[model samples]
Each structure stands twice: as structure tokens, then as C-alpha cells.
Target: MVNRWASGSLAQRGQANRLSHGAAIMPVLLIVGGGLFGSQAAAYARSRGIEARVFDASLEGAASPAAAGLFKEAWAGKRLAEHYRRAIPVLDRLYGIRGVTLKNDDGEDESFQCVPPSAILEKKPVLAKVTAVGDGWLETESQRHEGWVYIAAGIWCQQFLPELAISGKAGAAFAFPGEQPGTIHAIAPGRQAIAFVRDPGFTHFSDGTAERDYAQEHEQATLSRAAALGLTDTPVMRFWGYRPYTPGGPVFRRIGERTWLATGGRKMGTIVGASFACRLVENELRA
Candidate 1:
């Protein structure tokens, strides 16, 4: 199956209206990033009647591709999980399941797999296994782990949206020290385990023409924090990606009149981004 959307008919139906209303006729909705969220948003929008475009720099700082790609359930919370459950059918239809092997936090080896309808009748059934974390489990006995697949965000986003945004940031990932289990790591809301400060004069990637070196500063700060967290020896892998920075709260805003800002998922960008896109189309773009 080509991993493309199936809503061309819907687009055809809306063609006349799109041509009629220029303001609402976003001949193309412009997306500013090419990470997982950006790519998925473009896909979901195109599947609807809306034309979507993505602009990406494919910079070293882009975070999605470098992410561990773990879709831990805890991140979804209650409301987001409901939204996710509602969106699952669409996601399953657009991108089906795959097989994977996962090691849970309890050091138990398990099978994780995405079972599309085609495998429903198979003899070997996929089963879920409980791990140390109350909500943690690995998809065992299918093919492989259920979650965590590479989306090729850079290529997929551009191939689907074919637009670009020129901004970047630095992000990093590190394996927990061997002493720790491979379960989901949870950080309490508003809890500051490590100390750091955003430069008093930090600039949003879209703000101004700015050139500042924060890489060393970031690395040193991260290392110091990791040391405090007792993971000093863990290897740190870095990535560059931009997330909307909002101290008040995360939001999806319309800048000026045409440009829309759908950024800032923090760590859950991929999960929430797709859901947000679906809602954006149904509520904002659908005619």
C-alpha cells in the first residue's frame, strides 16, 4: 500500500467552494516545520479537502527523526488518549501496524506489533505483557514492538507537503544508565529536577535574524543536569528541531491572517500533532 491519503474525492467535492472563498480557500495551508508532526499534519490535511504545504530546513537541530519514537501511553493522559482512540482508525487506515521486539522497564523481553485486519485471522495472536510501570507493556508475540517506527519525517513531510520553513534548534537523547530499567520515564509537571535558564535574550526561530551559539552552553548544562540526575556516563545524542515556546501554555494560533502556528508539543509533538491536525481540518478548514 502506498502510504498516501484516501481523501481525493473529498478534495474534489470541495474544489468549487475552495475556488469561491479566497480567504477560506487556503489553496495551500502552509506548515513551517518538517518533523513528524509537520509531516503528519500535512498528510491529514491533504486527506481532507484542504491543500497543505510544509516548509522544512532538514537542519541538524530537527528533533522528530532523532527521537526514540516511543509512543508511551502515559504521555497521552486521559483526554488526549480519548482523542487518540478516536483517531486510531484513521491512523490505522493511513499507516498500519508493524512487528517489533521491546524490552520493558522490568527487563522482560516482549513482542510489539501493529496488527492490521490482514493478520486478524492468523494463528499466532499478538498479546500484551505488563511490565514494572503500572501502565507499561511491550507488544509481544506478534512480529515486533507495536509502536516506534521511523517516519522518515524529512522525506515524508516534503514529499507530501512540498513546502519549507527555515528554522532549527538543538535537542538530545540519551539512554538511561544501565542500572536503570528500560521502562517509561516520568517527570512530574512543573517539577524542576535540573537547574537551567533560557538566555534572557533568546529569540524564537521565526522572530528575527539572529545568530547565537548556545550549543556548548546547552551541552554543558545538560551534562551538569544529567550528573545531578545520576546519568553522567550515559552517551548523549543530539538533534535539531524547533518547538513553539509558550510559557503560559501550548497553543495553536493563527499568526497575522494566513499563517497558522501549530507548534510546541514538547515531547509529545508527534502524538498530539496528528490529533490537532485532524481537529484543525474538521473545525477550521472544512466547508
Candidate 2:
């Protein structure tokens, strides 16, 4: 059965307001970056009859594509309890979550997988870098866009808001030759190595390494964990990216009359992104 979220009816309804008089002139949402945060904002905007366009240069070390798309409530902990609750419903409405069993050496574990960002985004991002931004407007190399501006630039967001102390935690996830059974093996007492089918046709593995000064040793250690899982074949692909971190926690706030900034997804990009997207569209934008 086709899930309502994945159906074309929602897209058609999203465009319904465009045909209305006066509403047709509503400001378009100009989003910077095409990673999880930015894409989620765009998707939510579309659902609410707000037009949105995403500008992304597809810079190296983007975290969204590398994400395993797996998340659980425990990962959010107590501090992010509200975000976890808000995000799950939005994620479920946009992209149905599937429960999967993860086999571990000690026992079995449970996790949930949301569809990747590429699957939820309504359109491909315009391959451009936003050169400048202000209240309700932003400029690229040759064109200027005027609308509601949302900056979800991940770690590179520091360039836009120089005063905010933002940093990147880097890591790599490797994909082996063939499909493998889902498993989570302990890499350390608190850390675990994950082997799952994050993408079709490959087995994805990551050792949950998050380091500010990521080096060759970190990469080797991740590979070692994959080897311990008996995945010794030459990795078919390697995904390297940085998860943005803020001193306090995830950030979502209005920066200008019509501009909002969100980042600091860290290891919880999917949930944080969806939660912020809801706040941006439902509360901030519409209200």
C-alpha cells in the first residue's frame, strides 16, 4: 500500500494555495544548504503551501548523505525529550519510519530508519553558493533571491554568523561490497560498530567516531571495527563528513525579520532537523 506521505496528492495539495489570489505573492523560502536540516525545512515548507528553493554547492564532507538514517528515542536523552517527541510525528508524516531489528554479538537490538533526505526532498537543489544574505533576501554569484531566508549551512554556518561558536566533528562510514545482515557490535563499553544496509546493494559500517582532530588513525580504527564484523572486502565506498556542534545544543532561532538559522545537529541530525523544520514552518513562518 502506498503511504500517504509518499503519494502525489500531498504535492498537489501543497501547490493549491499558489492558485489563490494574493497568496500567490507569498514570499518564497530561500534555503541555503541541501543537507538534512535545509532539506527538512524545504519539505515542511512545501507541505504548508510555502514555496521554497534550496541552494547547495554540494560541498565535500556533507553529513546528510553519509547518515545511516537510523535513530532512536534513547539517543535523544532527557535534554532533547521535547525535540524527540516533536520530530517523530513530523518524520512519520513526511516519511514513514520502519522498525528494524539489529543483531548484536551479545544479543538483539531495535532501531528505526527514516527515508533518506534525497527521498523526501521535493526537488533537486539549485547548485549554487549563497554569497550574501540579509532580511528576506540572499544573493548568489549572478542572481538575487528575495524571500524568507533560512540558513542551514551545517558547520560552514560559522561563516554566516561569525560570533556563534560552531565546530565540526568528523567521521567516516564505509560501505562494503554486498548486502549484509544488520548488526551492532561493541567497539567499546559505550561505543558500538554498526553494520547495516543504509543503502541498497551495500553494507554500511561506522564505529561512531566523532573527533575534532580526525586523523588517519581514526579512519583505521573504523576499518578495524568493520574487519571484526568479518567485512574484510575492499570497501566499495567511503563517506566522510562533519557533524556540526554548538556549545549548548541544537540551535533554531530567527536571525532577522525574515531570516532564520538552524544547525548543531551533531549525531542527531535527523531528529533535530525535523524538529527545527516543524518550528520554522508551523510556528515561526505561519504564525
Candidate 3:
């Protein structure tokens, strides 16, 4: 289903709204970040007998910029098709946690096969456990597909909402395509573009004009930056997210032995920060 949000009502919460509690005094989850990843982690911890608390100073970041530029990943094959293929696993993680589901008009199941990243940067590999819920189908990489759109990138806490997202250190703009109701299709840009990890530990891509680049690139600098990044203008949410440089990372750091130190998340204050808090709590519990 192609969905786009036509109205930004005050009462409306994006798909990432906080879940309600079952009873009073849920265990404390203590998440340090506040973006999408942070929210998901906090929600995950909460479901596992923890109450979530996210911390970040900047909420409005580049992802929210009005004219932030964007492009699709550098995929060689059918770009959107390949993107959906690659996004299945990540979406699976999100679905497992969020209990999300996607189906065709006839209420039939949908699936995608092995999807790979458009380009592999020099970043560490990441993984999550996989389990087949229904009849398995063979994807090039792995089978067991569920029908839903997917995009591959590092997850973050600040990716939750523009408000919770720490403000982007760099300014950017995004042109949103309002197609289906409540769905984010694509984004056009205007500046140098911003690239960094979000608070939750996922990479962020957006069209931005660097404070420094402004002098040289002028009004339409984001287009040049977009081309340089090799982005392909795929149908993903134009959310640039924030860069929370909160007092230096391991946001939940310790100064002494039997202690931990955390801060930073130069860009990813949400997920990393919240993860830091949860890790600390876990260590403390173990201690």
C-alpha cells in the first residue's frame, strides 16, 4: 500500500508513537536516546519488564528540514525493487518488535527475497535473529518473507520523530512527495546534504548545505552533495534526523571502576544514548 501522511495534526502520532502501559510502575527501561531506534529499544525493553526513558537535547534535526535533499541508495538493479528486497530483514526486526504487518488487497501474504545493500561502506556488520512464522519462501539471501516496504540503513533512536530527534548540527531541506495518505514516498533536496549516524545507531542521509559549503555551493548546493553521495532518490521517508552531541558520548558513562562511561553520538544521540543507559542498567543489575 502506498501511503503518505497528508495531515500533520497535533494529535496525530506517526507510526512510532509510544505504546500504552498495562499497569502502573512498569520496570524502568532507561533509554538514553530518543530517535526511532531509541524508541524501539525503549519499547522493546519495556515489553521485557523495563520502563523506557530516552534522553537527548536536540530533537529537531536535519531530517525535518523543509528542503532537505535525498536520493536512493546506489543500487545497480531495479532500485526500489532491490531496496524492498534488502529491507525485509530490518523490517522484520521492526515488525517483531512493533507487531506490524502488511497484506495485499485480498488479505494474502506478501514476500520479498534476499536483498543486499546498494553499497557497503567500511562499517561493521550487523545482524538480528530470524524466525519463520508462516510457510517459508526462498529469497536469494534468505527466505520467509512478509509483505511490507523496507529500506536498509543503521537504526537509530532519534529516527522516531522530528521532536525527539536531536537537531541536526548541519542544516538541510527536504521536498516531500505527498502521494498516498500517511505514507512517505520520496524527497528532493537543495543543499550539500547531511550524512551521519543517528542517535539510535543507524546512518542518516539528507540533502544539506554545510555551514562552510554555503559560501561556495550557494542556493542549490544539496544537489551537488546528493550526486557525490551516490544516492538514487528512492521512496523512503525524508527524515534526516538529529545530531545530538550531548556532552560527548557514552551518554551513560562512569568515572570509576565497576563503572561505565558513555556519551557522544555526535549524530546518533538517540539510539546510542539510550543503548548506553540500558547497558549501564544491565551492568548494574549484573553487578
Candidate 4:
């Protein structure tokens, strides 16, 4: 009664200040690498109203761009059945999967593809190399950032968590001048080689090759398979990259209070990335 202004105006100001402070301290997701895992995480974070930024050095031998973007539930097998199920919805929502039939000598193979555009991330990556990371912060050569750090550095993730036994299976896919009809031809007895249009204006070919030591012989073998599909002409481009493999399976784990790590996509980078993205955004961060 004696001092109404002091109680009323001061109380409103205090509430506003607290709200502002809370907003200021809200965690941003700091993603390292701009490949499938990092990009998917950034996209999911934005959908959940969490700020996110990607840092990538755009190092050669990243597997995401080279991926055929083809997948089927049967390919996941028993171990990754749950991952396949969880990944489909997120992939459909973010990138829009489409059904396609892969014609082969035996018959036809039914599968789905999600060919994300070249610019899949919301914004361009920071284009900086992340030199170090901790519980809630990361540093580039020139600056430091504080946030919920996520390391999705693909094969290079071993540099951060040295205890984890990570290895790379390197392979190459070739691209011809024009789009070719979709087909899958037998490369080996049970394995199939795919020759189809993945990127627009180019025909793509890849035999299921994951070699620890990629050599000219491996390249020749891939080319021989491509020739079997009548892709004999000199290729306009070759996509070479390393797929990361872990001992058990794909990894998605929290390493620190505000830090997480994920890798080991292997041949299933697209599905694994999307599934981990959903888990990180919908479960871990939100919880």
C-alpha cells in the first residue's frame, strides 16, 4: 500500500531479467563435421528449436557425398532392424525417400533412396577445423565456442576418442556423363553392382567394395563391374571416400555432461545418421 510501484514494477523487471538470462544460456548444438551425421543433427536440432552450427574442414575421403543413398530394410539385418525402422521416418521427413526398383538379371530389387541436395544443411558449415573439444566447448584455430558439442567426424572421430577402435573401409564410385537407366547387375555370386542415376546429369556406378587397402586392383575390379553394366566409357568423375567401421556397430553415446559422439556408419551412413539424429534431438537433448 505504501510502496505499490516498488513491488509491481520491480517484480516485473526481475521476471523479465530472469527470462532473458535463461534464454541467453540456452544450449546450442555444436556439430563437428558436415557429412551425413553432422548435417542430420543440425537439421534435427533446428526442428526442435535448438540452435546448431556445423564445422567442417571438407576433408577428402568423407563417405557421405560418395554414398549411393540407396537402402532397404532387409539390408539392415537383425542387428540394425530397430535402427532401420527409426531412421525411415526421420529420413522421409527431412529428405523425402522414394521407392525405386533396381532391375537385375535375376529379377528386380525393391529399395528406397533419399538423395539429398548438395546443400543439405540449413546453412553452410563454418569451414573451420575443430582442433579441440571438451564437455561443453570446442575450439578452432582462431576462436572458441561453448555449447553442447557433438563429434560426428566420421573416420577421423578416432582422433578424439583414441580408446575406441575405429577403422576405415575405403571404396570408389564412378560417374559417367549422362543419366543411365537404373539397373543392378551381379558383380559376384551373391553381391550386386549398381549402375543408376544418383546425381542429376550423371550415371553412377558402385560395386559393394569396402577394402582396408584400396588399390589400383580394387579400382580395376570396380571398373570391370561397371563395364559389365555397359558403363565402359571413361568416367567423368570418381568419388572416393572412407566409410568408418566400429568393432560392434554404429555408436551413439554421451561422453560428457554436454558432449556426445557418434560414428561407425560403415555402409549404412544414411540410415545410421538419421537414426542417431532422432535419438540425439528427441531423446538425449530433450531429456
Candidate 5:
């Protein structure tokens, strides 16, 4: 049976794990979609002494590159919460995550870097910014690590796995204006304090016609919400992309006896689904 739910690390463990214990080389697993999920999958597999190749059209509007790079924890629903638990530690170990927050008591903004496992395992705050002293104030340090830029990560995977395939498409999907770095806030709807990403327009896209009009509508709605929240300065960026969804949720479909279809990441493709898919495929191949 193949285990499901997805999305690792490097260094002293050896950046490349294609061969270990003088074992035979592993077979290459072909993963489609170069978004966050695919990149994470490839990276995870490489670290486990498995060879994996990722392919993406890299078309304009592809979700990964256009993504705001928000890494958030899921608090609702057992399935998603579990995915978050599995992914967070591994992602943090491999790539240090930068913490950002506009919420503070000193009326000052702050940022910090962290490795999740170290923070989690040691039960200590690695780079936490203290907002209060005594009692509850110390709890913030236990949480750390979350974020990604899929496109650049895919490129990095190629460096680690030289034979990895990452063919660029002809047309670029989205356009990023201005050279200055910008901030994109992740807001979780309702009572949850965690900021998860959910674009109703993209998540509910019906066909090709939707994207042509999505920008204007998305901007207007975002602005309205921002205004209501008194966050008028929040920048809204729009892009078009395609995402595949399966009713059974993401799974590893065995194609014949050798190949497998690792997809169905849906909205959580980048952070949760992608990582899970990669690991699932890696384990199957090893078995």
C-alpha cells in the first residue's frame, strides 16, 4: 500500500544521497508540475538516496512562481493539521525560514530566522521576538519555519541533481513589477490566528474564461477586505495558473507496474501536498 499526504534537508547528512552503503543506484521518478510541491518532492527524494526528476511547462500564470511565499500552519481539520505537522520540521531543517510579523507590543516590526526542528525538539525559542515576559510569552518560540519561492527552489534542485529536468516554457505566466522586495501577508479567515492562503477565485476556477476577468475582481475584493481591516497599504498581485484536483484528494497512482502519478495537491500543493507527494513516491520506489 502507498502512503499519502506530502512534502526536507541537507548538509552534514550529505547534500547528495543517490548512493549510500555502496548500494545500487535508485531509479529516477518523474514528477510533473514544478510548483512548490514538485520542487519539495524532488528535494526530499534527493536527500533520501532516491533520484527524482521534475518537469513543468513553467507557463505564465503558473502558481508556484506567482505565489506569495506564505508558509502557514493549519489548525482546522485533522487531515490538513497532520500534513502541516509532517511538513514543517523537514522543510525547516533543509531551508531556514524567515519569520515576519507586523504585530508587536513595542509598536515596532521585527523579523527572525529559524530551523523548526531545533526549536521544536529543544523546546526553546531559537529566534523568537519577545512581546511579553513571564508565563504565556515564552510559548512563541516553539513555533518557527514556514515559507518558499518555488521557481528558484526548482533551479536549486537542478544544481543538486544535475540530471534533473526543468525545461522553461515559451511564454511567461506572471509579471513582477519593481525591483524592490515587497511583503505579502497571509490571512486565515474567521477565528483562526494562523494565516493560511486561500484564493477563492483561483480555487474555484471553472474554465479558461475565469482568469481573463479574475484580476479586476480579485483586486476589488482584496481592497475591500483590506479597507475593512484598516490595512489599505496591502499590495495585491494577480497572476493566472492552472491546478489539477482529484476528488479523492492527492494520491500516488501506480501507472502500470513501474511509473506512478504523484499529484492531486490542490490548493496546498506547494507547502503540504507537494512535500507529501515527493516522500510518498520516494518510499514506493524504495520498496
Candidate 6:
């Protein structure tokens, strides 16, 4: 196979394998949809071996490339943060996955890293259960890795809510390629987070849509944006529909008989999304 994502991380041990075998391999029911919450949750099911099928409306709606597979802890609140923190182990164990390109499902990762990334592993918790934790390609003591977290591309949330609501004022995003060579940069920062990237500049087919080209442009623009904002290298990503804005933030609900949904708010759903999937699995299995 061409490899959708990449081979499992050795540091993750057999966690990915176990997630697929233990969580997905078992008898389970699956429901797939769009919206940041549903799309990532469905992808989590697949990573866990749930073989959760997807129902995508368009190509870009389901966007995570290889980079999407990376995980992070860049959310908004404590409860949400803890919730994702709780979901990591379930994700770590879900190591063995195929059918990946450089990007997430949406074909974006190759624009970032080519080979499957190397992870620095750790101990993560699934509620009271301790599980293996695999960080992303980038290594740091903090879980908040400022990179992409591949989870079946941009996620399929847009399907359910085609007009995904955003908070920022409506504004047009302009595209620019860079000096580094491959990356493409499109910035449309606003008061809140109303930036609609699903329809990023390159949504339509283009001739020179190479990753290196886009990277060069993005890198240069990123440098300028950083300096203008008077900040060090800060974190910015596909914070579309429902991306967290708090230290421990995410989608959750304790209202009904017992149903909750959580994914990393930012694009780092790999770790955060997996963490939530584990909780969902545990609840289903335990129930």
C-alpha cells in the first residue's frame, strides 16, 4: 500500500496495535458525521480499529494529512484539558495504522513531513487506567506541540453543519507562498476565531500546489506575523469549528445518561482526539 499515514511508532510500543485490536477489533457500533466533534471521534474509532466508516460531503471537509496524525494538548480549559489528558493512552495504544499520505485524510500532511514521524513516548491516563502515551514527531516536555495532529484530515464536521459557525468577524484570507520553498501561507486572523480555512486559498485545483512551495511562503509570512504581533514563535493552526481556546478545553456533556465528545480544540487532535476516543470506548465497553 502507498501508506495513508505511516508505520506505528516503536516508542509507542504496541499501543497502536492494542488500540486497534482491543478497542476496534471488538464488536462495536459506529456513527460518523461532520462537525469537529463527530469527524475526529469517527477517525478515533478507525485508529482504535473500530473501522468506523465515514460520511463525508466533500473532499476538503475530511482534511488531515500526515501532519494531522501528530497530536497536541493545546486546548482551552482545565476540564477539557484533563479530559484530553485522560484520552492519550487509548491513542498511544492505537499505533498500527496504514493508508496515510504526508497529510491527514484531506491530503495535507505530505506538505509537512514525508516519513512517518518519530515520537517521544510517555505515561498517560485513561481515567484511572494508566495507558501508554505517544507524543508527536516534535519532542518537548510539554504536550502542547506546535504542529499538526493528523486525524483523518481537517475532520468531517462540516458535513453535518455545512455552514460551521465561527466567532471572528467575516474577512477574506489572502494566500502567499514563501522563501523556504514549499509551504503556502494564508492568514486571516480576526477579533475572535471566525477564520474559515475549509475553503483555504488552494481549495480549487492549481498547477504549482507543491508542499515545499507552500511552506516557503507560509514560513516567511509566519515570521512576519510573529514579529508584528510582538511574540516569540507562538502556536497557530486550523482552529476551525469548536477548536479549544482554554487550557483544558474541549467538547463535553454530562447531561444525558452518559455521553461525551472531546477532541483537541486546535489541530492537535491526534493526542487530544485519541484521548477522548478512549473514554468513549471505555464507556461503550464498560457499559
Question: Each candidate: RMSD to true structure?
Answer: 16.9, 8.3, 19.5, 9.0, 16.9, 17.5
Which 10-residue window of candidate 5 scores lowest in summed lDDT?
130-139
* Alpha carbon lDDT of each predicted model: 0.40, 0.83, 0.31, 0.82, 0.38, 0.31
TM-score of candidate 3 against the unseen true structure: 0.33
Q: Over the full model, what C-alpha lDDT does candidate 2 score relative to the true structure?
A: 0.83
Give lDDT tens digits, candidate 6, residues 1-287. Answer: 01111234433423433564476323322222233334445555555555443322333322222122322344324544665566555544444332322222233543221111122111121112101112222222332111112222232322222333222111112222211112222233211111111222321111111121234564444345434422233333321122322233444332112122233344444445555556565555335
User: Between the candidate structures 4 and 5, which one is better when assessed by lDDT?
Assistant: 4
- Model 3 spans > 4 angstroms off: 1-27, 30-33, 53-59, 62-168, 173-219, 224-242, 246-250, 254-263, 267-278, 285-287
TM-score of 5: 0.49
Instruction: Please list the residue runs of candidate 6 whose C-alpha ends up more than 4 Å from where it truly belongs after superposition.
Output: 1-28, 34-51, 59-63, 66-81, 96-220, 223-248, 254-264
Q: Rank the candidates by lDDT, best first.
A: 2, 4, 1, 5, 6, 3
lDDT of 5 by residue, 150-217 (tens): 11222223332233343321111222222322222334432111121223222111111213234555
Better of 3 and 4 by TM-score: 4
Estimate, for each residue in 1-287, the C-alpha lDDT of model 4 and write its tens digit. Answer: 01011232333333432454465345679999999999999998898899999999889998888788888887788988989999998988877886666787877665656554353543689999998877677788899777778999999987777777899999999998888788987667646798888878988898889999999999999999898888989999998999999999999989876689999999888889989999998888888
| Weakest lDDT window of 10 consecutive positions for candidate 3 | 131-140
Candidate 1 C-alpha lDDT tens digits along 2-110: 1222343234434433445454334455454556565666677767756554544444555554343334355457745855564556455556545434443355654
Alpha carbon lDDT at 274, candidate 1: 58
Best by lDDT: 2
Off by over 4 Å in 4: 1-25, 107-109, 116-123, 188-190
Clashes of each: 22, 0, 75, 0, 11, 74
Q: In model 3, how large is the Cα lDDT of residue 17?
A: 34
The C-alpha TM-scores of every prediction are 0.48, 0.89, 0.33, 0.89, 0.49, 0.36
